[model samples]
Each structure stands twice: as C-alpha cells, then as structure tokens.
Target: MAVWSLWSLLLWEALLPPEVTHAQVQGQVGGHALLVANRPSSFQVREAIWRSLWPAEELLATFFRGSLETLYHSRFLGRAQLHSNLSLELRPLEPGDSGNFSVLLVDTAGRAWTQTLQLKVYDAVPRPVVQVFIAVSGDAQAPKTCQVFLSCWAPNISDITYSWRREGTVDLGIEPSGLFTDGPALRVSLGPEDKSVAYSCIVSNPVSWDLATVTPWESCHREAGPGRASYKDVLLVVLPVLLLLILAGVSAWHLGPCSGKKKKDVCADEVAPEAENPLV
Candidate 1:
C-alpha cells in the first residue's frame, strides 16, 4: 500500500498543472464550481471521496467501484455530482460555500491520491449609482458650457473596475479639454453639442457587472444668471407675503381707535333751587 501511494503521488505531480495548486479558484454565486483531479484518462478509479476542510472537515460526496455512494451530506445533496474525469461539480453555489475542497482518489491498484483546492464564491454586484457634478466657467461671455464630473459607485464590494461609454462607444480620443479618467469617475467639459449624448458607467468584478446610464442634459442644468428666479418659484414665495400684508391691513382697520364712534358729554341741571326751597 505504501509503495502504491508513493507511485500515485508521483503520478499526480507529473500530471497536475502548477497553477491549479497555487491559485484560488473563484466561483460566482448561484453558479457551478469544478474541482478537478487531473487524473490520466488511462487510469481506472476504484473509489474516491470529496470533502470540505473549512468551518469543519466534512464529507461531501463519495464514489465506490465507479458508482456514487449513498452517503452524500445534506448540504450537498441534489447539488453535487462526480464526473468521469475525477472532477467534482458543485452547482448553485453560495457565498457560504467558499472554502477548501479535497478529493481522495484510489486507483484500481489500491494506490491512494489526494488533492486540495481553494474556492472563493462572490455575490453579484448590485447596479451602480452614477452621480454627476457640474462646474461652470467663471466667465459669462464664454460658451454656455460647463465641466461635468461623473462618479460610479457600488456599495460593499471590492476588487471592482469602472469603465465609461459615451454614446455607446468606448473611444474618447476626441474628448474636449479638462476631460480626465480616474479610478471610478470621468470628468469632462461638455459643450452644447455634447448635451444630447448619452453616457454610461459600467462597474464590474470578476464574478459580475452592472451598468448605469445618464445623459449630459439630465446631469447638468444650464447656469442661471444672477438674481434669476423661475416665475413659479417667485409666485410661490411672493403670494404668501402679499396675502399676509392684506390680512394685516384688514385687521388694523377693524381694531383701530378710529374704527368706533366717539361718546357725547352729558350736562346735569343745577340743584341750588331745590336746596333753597328745603331751607325755607
């Protein structure tokens, strides 16, 4: 048994690619991941056991005499299968499925071979939010144009990339001055002609991508002149003040001292004649 194990180890070393052992395999959520054994086509497998090593070492699936055994764990039931190539397939993978996978294969000659693989599963990124900033030129006489800065963002994600598309095209060779591309943002000065063009921001990771679109007119508004106010906005503010002034004038007119008639003075008759008659 020892000699056969040593021989199987040597065979694996010769057949396995170097990258398969060194790099971690990435899988998308709700997708499938394959753990390859890289066994030679000529080799006949007698038995195999696929196991997980992280969170806890647990048996995932098993094969005996070229047939799958009845001892699959509940977590992998209906979702795991062993292929003829000695590869294990896990379907509908989830974020919690990320871990180390190990496979032990025994050949027809009772030779034991084992391999371990690292798997990482990630959730699909959400649709990105695009924010726009407009910087107006100080000079009024200059063309009625402004610098537009666009930023794309996705929350709670890492290892993401950002790309910008203008009018469904990727080329920006003819961009105007002040145009710049940063990590997740694009800054450009837009003239009148560019206002009608559509822009899109794409955010992606290894597993998934999301996109957001906007037009220059939607993000940027024409600069308002000094003291400029829309008629609706002016009416909204002025109507309330005018109503209050009219109410004040009406109240004052009703409550003021001059609103009521003045009272008349009364004169009493002299009582001296009455007093003299009583003395007599």
Candidate 2:
C-alpha cells in the first residue's frame, strides 16, 4: 500500500506545470507548413535529444554544434537562475530536411519527456536565366520580334525535370537535354511589346521543387529609336535656315545701290548746246 502511494506521488510530482508543458520553440521557413517546435526552456534542463528527418549523410556536425550552445544558455546564466527551453538547429539543411523531428527531455532525476515536431524543408530552386534579343522593323512605329533563350540551373541537383510557365499564360512544353549542358537554352519568339511579360521556370528533383521568374527585355528594343534625325526632324531644322535667308534679303533691299540717286543728264546737255547755237 505504501509503495502504491509513493508511486502515485512520484507521477504527480513528475507532471509538469501547464505553462511548462505548453512552452515551445517554433521556427518556420516559407509558411506554417514548414514549422518546427520544442525549443528548450531557459532554466536547468538536464538533457536534450535531437532527432531529424533529414538524411544523416546530408546533416553535418557543424549545424548542430551552435544550436547545442543555444539550448544550454540557461545553464550558464549567472544572474537569473532560470532554465531556458531547448532548440534544434541543423547545419546545411537540404531538401531532405523536410519531415518530422522530436526532442526528448531528461530531468535531473533521470525521468524523461518527449516532444514531437513536424519539420518541412523546402527546396530552393535556382533562378531561371533568360537571354533576349530583338529584331526591329523599318517603320519605327511597327512592332518588333524578340527572340528569347531560357535555361535553368541548380548544380546541387543531379537529376531534375524542368517546366516553363508564363505568368499570364499556360505552360510550354519542356525539352530534355538528357544531361547537364552549358547552354540548356530554349528559344521563344515574342514581340517588343511583350518584353514586359514575366517568364517562370519550375525545377523539380525527387525530393523538392523550386521556382524562378525573369522579366523579358530586348537589347535592340531598349531605346525608343536610334539617335538620328528623321524627315520631320529635318524639317524643323530647315525652318531656321529659311528664316536666315529671308533676313538677308530684307537687309540688302534696305541698304543697296538701287536705293541711291541716279546719274543722268550729261548726254542731254551736249544736244541742248547745238540747238542753242542755231537759234543765235
């Protein structure tokens, strides 16, 4: 009877306070789906256990080393005699890190408690690369054609399937290179006006997926037009030349030989003298 009573007392004493049991550490990347819990308290915690769904090969010791210190900070606090909650950190997290984990807590009296965690690792997709070149028409106002080449890169991934999506449109078919190449380039034709449209690339491995968006631009279409003069532009230029010609004509008319008095009367004087002699 005494043994039963003592065991009951032990169980009650081992039961944590509601607040302590409710204590947790939560970290998420991307969204709530990628959350992890069970950060240690900043008080005297006797033990901490880390379990990860990530592949043991992918997880390095360096990742867990700092987190261990972070979890044990409560034990080192000189002023406040408070125990801190434990935390889990993995170094060099990979797509495989997506899954579940648990941390077991052992008390000074050797009793143990465990917490369950659901961890989701999101694979980071490499940004899609696109190169665009434009061909213009003779008419400056006319639309131009844009030639685009797209490629995707994720060196960390060995085998992957790729897909291209236009933001406002549907999916385009994927071409397989069968192996990695420097120019995994895809050619797409567009108009200069459509250069503002965004293109997206979706990269997927067996474990994860990543996406990247690139705004299309044209090299030839970047400028409004080449820095040159047109017929209308030349007409604006000729107006000044025409104004100068008119000004010169008016100045000559105002101050010229035509405006001076005429030289006359010499020949008429000789004839008048002959007529006067006959009369005498």
By TM-score, who's the top model here?
1
17-123 per-residue lDDT for model 1 (tens digits): 42223336788999998888766556577766677888678777766655664255657777888777668888999878888887767677655566778999888
Q: What lDDT score is found at residue 74 in candidate 2?
A: 23
* lDDT tens readout by residue for model 2, 127-235: 5444454433355543555555666665655456777766665335553442222334555666656767776667765455677777665344453335755457778
Clashes of each: 0, 18
* Reference-based lDDT, residue 183, model 1: 66
Quick one: best lDDT, which candidate?
Answer: 1
Q: After superposition, how far is residue 136 of candidate 2 from its true place, in Å?
A: 11
Model 1 regions more than 4 Å off: 1-23, 110-112, 170-182, 222-280
**For model 1, the run of ten residues with the poorest summed lDDT:** 260-269
Query: What TM-score, over all chains together, does every model reach?
Result: 0.65, 0.30
Q: Which residue segments of model 2 deviate by more than 4 Å?
A: 1-124, 133-143, 170-183, 223-280
Model 1, residue 60: distance off in Å is 1.1
